[model samples]
Target: MDNRSYFLEEQRCVKKNGSQEISAHCDEELHFDIPPTAAWGTTEVQLREDLTEERQETLEDTANAFQGRGRVVRNNTHFCALTSCPRILQNKKKGKMGVTFRNSASEGSIFIGKRTVKDGECCGVWDVAGKYSIIMGPQRKWMMFSRFIFMDRLIADSHQYLEVRYRNGKKENKRGPLSMFEDPIVHESIAVMNAVTVDAFEVIVVYSEDEHGNVKRNVVHGPTVFIPDVNQWLHVFRWHGSRGKDLHEKVPGALVFTKLRTIPDQFYYNAEGVRTADDTSLTVKVMVFFQLTNLEVMLNSTHDPIGDFINALLADLMNFGCSYSYEQFVQNAQQLSELDTFPVMCGRASAIGFTIGKVVYRGYAASTQLQNLCESAIKTRTELKLKAEEQEQRERMRDYEVRGAHGRGDAERAEELAKQEHQLAMRAAQHQESLKQAEDAHSKALRQKEQMAQVELAAKVAEEQAHLAYLQGLKDMGVDLTQYLVSKSEKQPDKVLKVVTAPSHFSALPINSVSHIGGLNIHTNV
Candidate 1:
């Protein structure tokens, strides 16, 4: 048997010549044969059959890959088409002005210096000739063509607001992102203005559209979100106007430029009223502090909210004043500031989106008649106090006098007691001395009696000794002693004589009988 082989292939390519494109085919195949020597032989062949649609699609994909093209549709007719050369805008100096415009007249139609337009071109040079309109397109886009314009001294300080006003009446009020440009947009329809800054210490009632298409109202402190379109209207209500200027004299219009900071409004009123109870008249000075709370409500409720608030405040003050007498009003004047009487007033203002911060009673002056009565009352109180003090002083003096008299009496009594005790002591000492002297005299008398007794005893003893000596001398001269004794007895006849006989043995008794015999009678004491 002989070996056989067959192969089929296809290829496609895209060819280009300058700007022309052409599609062509490149396909080849080969057949192999064995000769008698068993060597290999080859034959080239070209296929001429039509390809299937699927195969043709594959061939087209291969052709596209070769051409280096992706599957995206693009139109080059209107892509950056310009009729003439684009002029590069010159950079403006820091203090110069320019004009800008946008052509929204037609599609592929732009105006440049009144020249005729060509086909498939959309841009042209714009200068200070016509009105600038933001071209609205099918893509809902706006286009502006302009050069930069600058200002010499368009500064917005921290206390100033830079306001931008467009020709369509939209406004932007801000404080920061500072620039030295009056009108930053190089367009004839726009202008740069000034406004008082809404500082952080103040609030502004702004009317704006919300996401739900409702006209929303709220307070804004300082700069709000920025918007550059000229489709919205704006107005600012401030407590005060620009510095060094009055509110009425502040330039009006949406584009007027006056940089300032927001401050709270303070209203001072000097009013007169008659008290209800006493018919007394009073002049009062009061201060009112207030701020705007909502722009839409404020504008809707009244044409002039500030003036309305002041009038309402005065009415409320007078109403409150009528409730009390002159004295009561003077004493309770602070009640004017109380919110009790302000509810009705506050309600009227709050309907217009205005709030009262505070109300201060500055001062009040009464009539001359009331002043005289007050002075008299004060004088009376002073006199009463002085009288009470005088009475207290008199009582204190009387108490002092009583205490001094009691002290003097006590001193005198003490002195008298001391003197009496001293006298008693002296008398006792004298009595003791007298007793001592009497005892001494009694002792001396006893000694003298003893001496006298001793002398009498000595005299008796001497008399007895002399009598014995005389008797002894009589006994020694014994010549007639018996006779002498008898003679002496005779001479003293009254003297009794006694005779004594010696004791004999026969007669031991009867001595009296014997003495008689001896011729002498002797009376004897034996």
Candidate 2:
């Protein structure tokens, strides 16, 4: 057979030797053969606003698993009376043991109530469970408040604490008939709550002192820091809030925040009662920018830091203006830029916790009579320069025309030489051709003369052959042909006859009566 036994984490079983032993906090059952007597009990403990989840559970028994446990703490209800601040609520718990509120500045814890806690006891033991209420108070010196309450209940339930703190000179005032229960305010260095938020343009300086007793500084730029009391280990220094606009009144020992930005339209000056290098006076307007830097150091250094910076800037500008003539300054007025002013202004402003950013020359103008004279001089100079340039250009044109005429003369001479050479070559070719034709004609004439002479000689030879043949024929016929011809010629006197008087019979009869000489004798005629 098995015997059943159960216990909780906050429960401790007492033995005969007075030593104690604790049990598991879960719903586990142990089997014991002897079935020794067992009793259930609880511990009484105080939970601060910042206690962790694991540590809080150690102060409770296994009875915490019961439904609706530890729900009656007041500060845990998410109640805040700072009317200027907005609240955002999100309920994330589920089932019967759900969380209904949330706030970082104030918090609460659960309890198994109706138990008397001893002075040095971290927890109290209880025989039976009872109703629980909230117990809340400040844990830092800067969190001290002279008059703090909500919905007619004491803010910290410290009536006796107020009277004690008031008599100690730690607080200036106390609230109501509940002043008898107060305690002295602490954390004079300053404490900030997580409920506070800082803007992007703002900065919070956590001022304190080091171990050597000198002042120390910690900077917070925001967006925000969630917790401020966690940094109270250092001593107090100084605080400044909201550089842009007024947001909160001075809260003693609270984190002070402020911003850094440019202050515009600060320095507007008209240049007057000052003469330039040329003794010409002009009107000039200028502007500048100013910002805060080491504010804590500045307060101790000077009563009016901004005024000192402005005066130094104007004095330096006056000196710079004297270095340039009226025309020179107006022509290149932009030379009076930020680079020229920052160095001089910063030198004087460093003692006042201010920084110089930019300087600008807005505008400038001269007197009307002086401006007219300047304009006339400028126009005259421009006209003279134009006339000189025109004369130079005319000289260049004359030189070009002369060069062009010389080039045309050289080209014409070359063309004439080429024409003469061509004419000489054509004449030479014509002379050679005429000489060849004359030679050909002379040769033809000589050939024609020789041909005519040959034709005449051939004709003479043919006539002589004919004559000889004729004479032979007459001889062959045995006729006296010469004599016949002579007789024939004698009958025709116009015909001439040549006679060879080798004197044969033909010659002998050549006398005038040869008519009958060959046949009949002519004795009577003789």
Candidate 3:
């Protein structure tokens, strides 16, 4: 609390002490040796004493103004002591030069510099030093970048390939399972295209440039790979829909046909309100089958083969149907399924490189009234035929019965005739036996009569011989033969006979001398 003022010179002090003496207060300087690693290195610093009174007063007044504030104020205007510090010295360290780029083996980018590099090659410090750029050339110009393109399995199996077209019109083909970047020519390629795959049953027509650069058409068969050149392309085929009175809408489309095998197709047609010869209206439905024979001829002859078939078939059906009445057509409807019914269609098909296989008249449709009438007529005709057949069967049965009765009667009459002939033959045999026995009895009686006559003649001859001998002996004894004859005549008087008609002169002679009396001469022993 003592308020007083005092003054002190340099290097001296005034104190409360009784005697005056020399003061130790003086301006001192301090030196600090900072190392190179610190912010400031190898520098000197000085500490100054409070020597000015005015500066002290000014500080005292500032302190009095902020006496009750609880915070201290600092002056940082001269916090740094160095006058010119070199800009914060940075450490000098070496680093890598080039930017890193990463990519897969299947993918790649073009880098242009002194030389081109691709196919997933790495770029290092040496590349950057050589001024190489990715997908860029000198002056940062854009360049071509390509990645690996894989062919599909189906295409590869079919022997298909890819064609690379160059900017100079040079063409080259590459097979599948390859990368574009692997080949150096890819850098100069303008485009790459896949080749067309041909199957076993297919064919293709193409327009291509020949060796002389002239465009010409050529046909390529199946089972091969068709790689077109830079100036080659496939031929486009357009198909038109069928057009006819029976068709309501035209069908339009594009298709490629198979030329190596047989192709089958069918179509239906209807003829409405068609009149027959008997003025009967009918709706006829027709179906047809066709096959392609020659493809070149078909292309040249017609634009729509199916349309031609329908038209031709319709014409033939109309001609045939109109020629017959309703009844006649019904009887001959079977002819419709035959090939002869569609002569016009067949001829047209052959001309247009096609063959018609079969034609079927699906049948006809008529009004209800006409159908009912036809059914009635058929029923009546069938009934009449059945009745006639039954009558004929009855007549045949009656004729067979009559023939059987006549055969039985003829058999009985033959048996009766045989019995009568047998009886007549037995009677004739009995009569012949009786005649033979009677003739044998008459012959035996005649033989016995002949034997008896021969015995009697022999006895008479013996007696006459004996009598002559007796007469001869008597004559020799002088006996007379006349007496002996008389004696024998007397013994058999009945057998003796006399002659009455003698001469008159013989009667006069004696009876004893009759032998001489007839002549008038007797010699009797008189």
Candidate 4:
């Protein structure tokens, strides 16, 4: 690893026919129509004359072989149809700006020209020439990052040092040994983006290290499932998706992936025992929406502040909960995801969590492989969350009291209300349990239906295989089914010529269709 710090940059380029062949050699000769070295993610940018242009690095998603008759799909709204995308195509049509993970957009046209730039600024622009989103469907992804690289010189490395590290708590007292998730496992170079919230959010420290074992922690979240602060997480709600078969599932058809949490409309928080706004006895039921995304995680309360803010407030309130357990993590996610409030009896207790810090996003050289890492992060988040919940339940049975200034008598009436509030909450919890059971049943039914469909598909494929075998057997016996099935008055028909002009083109051939082709289909050209 180089002792000096290295800056990773992402750039955009479009490859066209007759252009220099770009196999795996994109690192050597690449032309950038819009080098947003100073444009992407910067507050201000000006082109450099006194300074040298920044050298950016972009990982190759798909290799360049030649394929003819490529068509462009514009304005595809779905995204999942693009996920698991085997590869992305490079379109080098002049006047056609290409789509890329690096953000670069023109001030005039979406795909026309480069926006203005400054020397030290890394431009945050969208690669907008309507490239299809493989996993997300036809909707292409725009570039998002904290910064880009500025270079005075370009020194190509046969292999540069890239490492990944993870930290659970504060940066000052970082814990754990550095682990590497590299090459095909961690595609798409690491880039940083700013988070809106700075308070107590759960943060993971991540970054690539150099070959010399020198480590850098620029990335805060990689393979981390938990996102703190609803206000900062960037999220997409819904999109379409495609399958393994070459058919568009969403319209203009494609696979789509959407972020569910970023921009929630409303947040729900329970207001069980809090005093009314007027200080008189008042009952209020409200929905609290705790919205989170790649940028922000914010809390919005309805009439009941406790309903909306409790989960976040509890992070500061109940500090005894452990992070190692799933119950704690889930209780945190639920409390955070749910709404909560305050101004209750000191004796009353509620489990809550907060936004300790930032969670980073990282991937292998190929973004597709990130799914395995993503799946692991997701599972870890869920399991730990569940453990936290069970621990919270045990805490409920404990009793405690706090002094309210100068030995003054605590409000007995308030204490009574708090006890009843706990009972009310217990009843509500029962109802929630019932709701969960119904959901489980519904999910099971869906799984069964899907399994049956797969079984039927397999049966059909197998039947087709058997029939093909029988046809070959007949051909081996010197019997030509095509001649046998021809018109009774006809002489030997030409076996070399084509018959039944059109054939089914359903990616995987339908075995049933072949059965209806009459005896002539049995004449296999063994």
Candidate 1: minimum summed lDDT over ten consecutive residues — where?
77-86
For each candidate, give its TM-score against the true structure.
0.32, 0.27, 0.36, 0.15
Candidate 3's TM-score: 0.36
TM-score comparison, 1 vs 3, better candidate: 3
Cand. 4 Cα-lDDT? 0.32
Q: Report clash pairs, candidate 1.
A: 194-257, 194-258, 197-260, 497-522, 498-522
Candidates' C-alpha lDDT: 0.49, 0.45, 0.53, 0.32
Count of backbone clashes, every candidate in sequence: 5, 17, 0, 122
Task: Report the error of model 4 at residue 245, Å.
Answer: 99
Error of 2 at 298 (Å): 3.3
Candidate 3 local lDDT, residue 123? 22
Instruction: For candidate 3, give the lDDT.
Output: 0.53
TM-score of 4: 0.15
Poorest lDDT segment (10 consecutive residues) of candidate 2 = 26-35
The model with the greater TM-score, 3 or 4, is 3
Any runs in candidate 3 off by more than 4 Å, and if so which? 1-204, 207-215, 221-274, 279-291, 357-361, 367-526
Better of 2 and 4 by TM-score: 2
lDDT at residue 330 of model 2 (Cα atoms): 75
RMSD of 4: 52.0
Ranking by lDDT: 3, 1, 2, 4
- Number of residue pairs clashing in candidate 3, backbone atoms closer than 3 angstroms, sequence gap of 3 or more or interchain: 0
